[model samples]
Target: MARIAVIGAGMGAMAGAARLAVAGHRVVVYERTQTYGGAVRGFERDGFRFDTGPGLLPLPAVWRDLFLKTGREPLESHVEAVQVDPSARHVFADGTEAALPNASRAGVVAALDTALGAGAGQRWGDFLVRARESWDRTRRPLLEEPLWPNWRVLAEREPYPAVPHKRLLRTRRAGTLAEIGAWELRDPRLAALLESHALAYGLDPRTTPASAAVLPYMEHAFGTWYVRGGMRELARAVYERCLARGVEFRFGTEVTAVVEKDGRAAGVELAGGEAAEADFVVAGVAPDVLDRVAGGLAERAAGEVPARRSAASRLTVLLALRGARPEGTAHRTVVHAPDRDAELASVFDGAPGPSARPTVTVLRPDDPALVPDAGHEAVVLSATVPAALGAAADPGSRSGDPAAGAEELITAATRAIPGLRDRLLWHEVRTPADIEAATGAAGGAVPAPALAAAGGRLLHPANGTRTPGLFTVGGWSHPGGGLPHAGMSGALVAGLIVEGPEFRGSQ
Candidate 1:
């Protein structure tokens, strides 16, 4: 059995470590922090718990597969995953509301029709039909398997089938997500609804490829899931699974360098100058962080997809309220920004400042564990913001302070939570700085999932590098970010190490 050293105790790394141990490899996970679960962290105060990272899980099959592969117990046995019916409630800029059902295309169409208009639902339904095509075309290559050696093929081809629209007496097809919203959906609210999915991942819909349509399709088909006791519980389950499989974990022991021997990654160097030799190394970190591993530029294989530097991060505000969560409340609510153009410009293009008015996502899970008592509620408000926050370029706008962003989120949330400020007993704000401290990601920039177009700017570097006996697994590597993608990253790395380069994908 090969000896393996895995860096970071993040979900992806742990997933790999567990599977490697099951494969009879001696695996040791070295984490810089005192705990596991990279950004999938939690905060607790007076019985109130909040997920500091991703609040929900999509395509749970990724984690489920990990559990099934490592042990006889299923994922459901470890933690209860509750699907939020009326998948999400959307509050448009025009004050219209639509509560889409969980995994029910017909229900979503009906709800959109009731709220947006007669043909609104059908338009969205048809768009989803096209989005499914994108998913089918890219799923195996992007999520289920390794990044193809010919990844440029994924970059050059657009999987989304955009309907031809005649403009200025010439026939053209939608290229970017914005074009899809305008030409296909037509209604401004419908456009906003369609764009929200991309924005949630910190992608600028204005420039994101139409292939991103697969995003909503993923959620619509697989459904949104919330793990009981916050998302951190899921992390705990994975960490425990690793331990069960005899994978060792050394927390608070930072790996300072990757030790190379005979031009291969043989082991890792710790903070206090200790070295643990291993047959293989799995790094679960951002590409920028990985470059620092070998004391300089890590070796890159020829034609490997280059790393991307993202500027977007999330501003999360955890609210402790003095009221009980009302019944029949949507588990998640997205309050659309009043000024979508300015908001996108501030986050993706304009100055590094807090958005004047950002699109806010309000999460109110009806879980007793999240509240101090029946009389209390815990709410999380999040918005995409620049990784670097500074004074507003627009002097009159509220731009500099994270407090300003928190205020904007609260104001937008008022539409979702009645008397929000009045009910707010206390609040805590988490910025990208916190993310950097937690994940070692530069500028606390969160990576978006890989898409099929936009010239492959959205794709992450291949998990395999030029260095022998070394591989990468995390949001920053192939298949990109998000909980499901990260889990898949772990599986891919394990597959590569166990089955060699010939392993096409999971059967």
Candidate 2:
């Protein structure tokens, strides 16, 4: 069995390490941060706990599979998610509000019909059908395998007869959400609403690929769920499972390099000049950081990185409040911008000014145990911001400080939520720069790779290039990012590593 070393203690690293260890291979995970969950981790300030990233948890089966495969039961330790109704509230520019119900296509369609028009329901249904098809056609071939030739071979075997080279054409260009809405639905608001879903990835809908349109359908099909305590519990559960399976963890130990011998990965070198040897390595860190660690390999495989389609960075404000929860708000609420493009342009322009006034996503833990009392509330206000702007802001600025651009962001978020400023007990703002400094994510980006950049045949792991005894997982690798997708990517990589390179050649 291979002696594997997985870099980063994020879900991706844990998933990979668990699979490798369960397969009877020795595994060691090196995490740069003291915590286990990279972005999904939580911290407490003054009797209030906040999950720093990934507010929503969908596809529990993915996590279940990970735990089960590692010889652990997830539900036994962690809280089963409570499926939420009116999955999220989206407020349009025209002051109209709509609710996206949990796992109910008919409910979402009816809501859209009432908010938009009579035919809007049918239009949404049609869109759902297409997205479902896209998901079915793409899910296994793209998401379940390491980037290799098998995906292409499968596509060739299952091509649509009407379109002679449908699979080939599908991979050539990425479809934007706007393009999909315009081409299929012909409703700008509907298009904007669909595009707005790109916010989950921290991307502007205009630039995001149409394939992302599949996101809503996936949510509807699988449902939006909240873990009993908080999303952070999911990370803790996975980490514990890894420990149970004999996976070793090295927290707060940053990896400086991926050691290579004879053009193949041998192990990793830590920040303090320590080295650990391994037969295989899975990099759960940012692709750019991986590029740095791998030395000129990423440059050589520049085409593989999907140039000009990096995901957008974020500016987040976390608030701890006292008093009753706000009325007319679901567990999750999205305050939409009048013009998304204009708002995104400001972020891309690297200006210090507010971009689109920020999209406010308010989350109040349903469980009383998460906070001191029922009156206690926690909210996260996040918006896409230029990576450079965060770098320009002062790092030491505190709440209400004049130089803290983040403080201004918190003030703006408070305005969006009535009485929020007065209710605030404690608050902290995390700029993209803070995320970069804290987590070592390149440019503080959180897995927002453009769909267009990810659409091609090479996007699948089973069809991509590989170095002997080396595998890549997480958002930087094929099939792209998202908690579940990253976890699955790690599992697929373990399969590839265990099965040998000849298994890859078959496809």
Candidate 3:
């Protein structure tokens, strides 16, 4: 059995530690903060709680596989994952609404047809068929296996099969996601729906490859899920599972460096200069953090000096309300921006400032666990924003705080929540600064999940680094970010470590 040192107690690191321990290896995890879960965090006040990170989970099979591998207990037995039926309700700019069903393509089609009129549903349904092709073409190499040495092949090839469109007798296929929306979907509402998926992940639809269609396809196929209490409960279950498997954890202990010896990662150096020697070192941090901790060893292997990609952060406003959460309300609602083009330009290209009309996602779970009583409700409003590294937290600043972007979020969310301003008892803003302090990511940037194409810019570095025994896991590494991708990154890292360099992927 090998002695392994894992950095950070985030979901990805914990997943790896649990699996490694189950493989009979000794694993020790060092976390900078007194908590686990990384971005999957939650906040509680006076008996009310809100998930501060991702409010929902997609591709839960990732965690399910982890639990199955690490222990005999299934994930469902540890945490009650409730499928969010009518997965999400979308409120378009034109006062039109559609509630998409969870994991049912036909149902989604019917709902769209009913809400948006005839032909609209068929266009989206057809688009999904193409998206599925992208998923099938890329799933194995992108999510299941180790990133190939020549990752450029994946970057150069676009897996999404574009539909032929005849514009004035000339035939052309859609290249970017924006083209797919304009050429195929046609309707502005359908275009908005399609682009929203990419925007949520901090990708610019106009620039993102058509392969991104796989995103909506994945969600429609796998469905969205939520833990009974909050996403934090899932983290607690994973942490407990790690402990049950005999993996040791040290919270509030920051790892300063990856100790190297003879061109191999020997172990890690802690804040107080304490060294824990190991045969293998697993780092579950951002590329920037890895560059610092590993002394550029990781950056060299990644073929870049910094090894980090530009990331987008989130601006969230947690609302504590005095009214009961209405019964039969959809678990989540997306209020689309009034001006789609302007909104995209503001977020991706224009000066860092609040969008005059920003797209906002409103989350309000019906679980009583989130409210002080039957008379109260907890609502969370979130928007994608630029990550200004090392900046102070500005919650809806009056000084044109572009990074805050909270005011626009509030304005957009009003469409989703009735009498939102009236029921608001208190509100708290969670900014990028808070994320940086919590997760150690520069600028509190949240890395997007891996995509198939885009000249390799979207692909994460390989799990294995140049330095022998050194590996990168989590959102910043192979398979990229998001809860499911992070979990898969852990599995991939463990597979490489336990099965040797010849390891292809998880069995």
Candidate 4:
């Protein structure tokens, strides 16, 4: 059995370690912090807990498969996987509202039709049919397989089949997501709804490829889910599964460099001059950190890293409310910005000043595990923000007074929750600084999922590196970010290592 050294105890790294250990390899995980979940961490105070990372789980089958393969217990048994009905309630700038049902295209159509008008639902449904085509065409190449050597094909080709629009006797297909929304969906509210999906992932809809329609399609097809406690619990379960498989984890240990022997990865050198030798090494870190540890191996293996997009990191506000979470309230609500063009410009175009309003997603899960008591509610408000802001990089930043972006989030969330300011007991602002501290991403920039266009800006580096015996898994590698993509990265890396270079894809 080969000795494997996994860097960072993030979910992807841990998932890879569990499978490798079960494959009869001696695996040791090195994490810089005492925790194992990376960004999937939780915050608690005075008996109220909040998930500092993603609030909902999309494509839960990834984790379910992990639990089934790693142990006899099903994921449902370990954590209560509850389906969030009426997936999300959207409050548009014009005071129009629509509650989209979970995993039901027909229901979503009906709701949109009822709220936005008769034809709105049909248009969205037609768009989804095309998005499904994109999913089917790209699913195998993008998610199920390691990025092929000829990845440029994936970059050059557009899987989304955009309908040709004939305007003034000229026919053309939509390229960017904005064009799809403006020309195809054709309604301001629908455009906002579509663009919000891209924005949530730290992507600029104006430049992101039309293939991004798959984002909403995946959610509509797979449904939104919630663990009984929080997303952090999912991370806890994966970490425990690794432990059960005989994987050793060393906390508070930072890997300083990747030690190479005869042009192959030998092991990892730690902060205190300790070295753990291994037959293989798996790194689950951001691209920048990997480049630093491996001495520029990232750029050599992955080509030119894409420039940091302005709309990258997230600004989250965790509010402890004084009142109970009322019944019949949708678990998630999106308050759209009044001036979407202005907001998008401020975020993606780096305008001189912040937009007066910002789109905000308000999450109020009914799970009793989050609140101090029935009398109180735990609410989380989040918005996409520009990465690399100088103020967010300061180490001593505090949440005493909300920043401009945070204030916009608070103001937008009030549309979802009436009397929001009065109901708040206290609030905590988690900026890009906090995200950087937890996940080691530069500027705390969250990675977007791999996509087919935009000159390959949305694509991630291949899992198999130019360096022999060295591989990268997680959000920074092939298939890119988001919970499901990260999980798939683990599977792809494990498949390549176990089956050798001839491995084409997961069967």
Quickly count the clashes in candidate 1: 0
Candidate whose TM-score is highest: 1
Better of 1 and 2 by lDDT: 1
lDDT of 3 at 448: 82
Candidate 2 lDDT by residue in tens digits, 424-462: 887777766766765567557666521323335324232
State the lDDT of candidate 4 residue by residue for 1-507, as single tens digits: 999999999888888888888878899999999999888988999889999899999999888888877776689877898999989999999999999999999999999999999999999999999999999989877788988777778878888999899888999899989999988999999999999999999888888999999999999999999998999999988988898899999999999999999989999999989999999999998877887898754444435334233347788888999989999999999999899888887777777743547788999999889987999999998888766652354421122234655677888898999999999898888888788888888877888888886667778878877789999988878888889988888888888889898878766
Give one digit per residue, the lDDT tens place, for model 1 in 1-507: 999999999888998899999999999999988999999999998789999999999999999999999987899999999998879999999999999999999999999999998999999999999999999999999998899998999999999999999999999999988999999999989899889999988899989999999899999999999998999999999999999999999999988899888988899999989999999999998766788876443655567788877778888999999989999999999999998998988887765645558888999998998887999999999988776542233121237566676778888899898888888889988877788778988767888998887888999988887888888899989889999999999999999999999988787
Worst 10 residues of 2 by lDDT: 157-166
Evaluation by TM-score, superior candidate among 1 and 4:
1
Clash count, candidate 3: 2
Candidate No. with top lDDT: 1
Candidate 2 lDDT at 218 equals 75
Stretches of candidate 2 off by over 4 Å are: 150-175, 297-311, 326-329, 349-354, 393-416, 449-466, 502-507
Clashing pairs in 4: none
The alpha-carbon RMSD values of the candidates against the true structure, listed in the order shown, are 2.3, 5.0, 1.9, 2.1
lDDT of each: 0.88, 0.67, 0.86, 0.85
Cα lDDT of model 3 by residue, 22-82, tens digit: 9999999999999899988999998889999999999999999999898777999999999
Candidate 3 global CA lDDT score: 0.86
Candidate 1 stretches greater than 4 Å from native: 295-297, 352-354, 390-398
